[model samples]
Target: MTSAVHYKTAWEDPATRQAWRRTAMFRCAALLGWLLGFPTWLFAVVMTPTWLLVLWLPVLWVGIWYTLLAMVAVTTLRGIRRVLRVYPWQVDIAEVRAKKKGSTQFVVPVPERPEKSVSLGYGGLLGTGQHFWVRAMKSGEVTSAWFAGDPRYVGVVATPGPRNLLWVAQREATDSRMSPRKRGVSPEARALARAAGARVGEG
Candidate 1:
């Protein structure tokens, strides 16, 4: 289901080359590889009896180790690709509400479940770390292609357009504390609140 109200962000600007690096994928893979070394060594030691009894067991273990190492290598390669590609993505915060028979219902966008990253190192063949980035966008009318799995949010991507701009806000404080009517409220939320006959001061 889609929300009828369409909102755009004047503040949504393109991301820089550095922003993608902060993504969870890069950090997770680095941690995974560093952490896996110990367990891998333990597994090899525990399987020694089997490796001695059957040559194939040793070979299989070696294969598994190498495969993991290769995964780490692949993850690093992907990270490099991100640095090179450096696409621009639009970030916007939105709230979706679905209408029921007569009343309106607030729809909670699906939350992202944390993922466990597996290290890509196994003994003997260039084992490396592999990190996977889960969905970062959701499918929607304006953002279907970049749409990730969580239907609650939508992030649109744009090519590196000719123009690059940054918007910054500076508030002039009359007093340290904002009046109850002048606190933190998003423009979109304020608009919605006003339309529903509610004041737009504090959320």
Candidate 2:
């Protein structure tokens, strides 16, 4: 949990934006999952006569499809609500105390607000050396967690360190925020600056 005094929600801009884009992509796969369900169901009916198999197939598909839909709705709304917002302070860091189920989930503890410990599963333990395909019930060992967005419900991300999307975005933002010449300013801006210099020299 490398929650720095500078972190808090300060990295929210990039975190939420990236989260939305990733969530959109994930939902696209969910759409595919939905479409494939028909064939998969047919296959189950034709190739597997076991009553238990047929009974569970649809149940599993519906569960996964609905879960993905819920995720899409949640992330999209959160992104819309706080995409442009930035925080310049600090707070308690969230913890990833669960496994990733094809996506990241978080659990942010809140014990003092006269309410339940808020924030739920998102990102999982990184550098855990565990194969992503392995469906382990446990999250292995979570050493660090970095979160962005609202701490209450919309904690958009919980990436473990050395792989923080917000950190990556921050670096890119830093590069972009450099001097105009270093960042390769637009030609129009250069022209305007030259004209301003000419006027100043004439004076």
- Candidate 1: list runs displaced more than 4 Å: 1-19, 23-39, 42-48, 51-87, 90-203
lDDT of 2 by residue, 1-203 (tens): 43333443443445444655675565567667666676766676677667768586766666565656545444454343242244322232655444444433444543234254444443233322232312232554543355443333233343433123321111222133442231233444334323322111111
Q: lDDT of all the models against the reference?
A: 0.30, 0.40
**After aligning candidate 1 to the native by TM-score, how far in Å is the CA of 60 from where it should be?**
5.4
Where model 2 places Cα greater than 4 Å from the true spot, the runs are: 1-16, 43-92, 98-137, 160-203
Predicted structure 2, TM vs. truth: 0.40
Instruction: State the lDDT of candidate 1 residue by residue for 1-203, as single tens digits.
Output: 21211113211222333433343354466457655755765677687775464654565676566556545544443433221232222233222222222221212222332232111111122231121111111122221112111121112121123111111011111122543233334566344333323233444
lDDT of 1: 0.30
Q: lDDT at 107 for candidate 2?
A: 48
Backbone clash numbers for all candidates listed: 16, 9
TM-score of each: 0.24, 0.40
Q: Which candidate is the best by lDDT?
A: 2
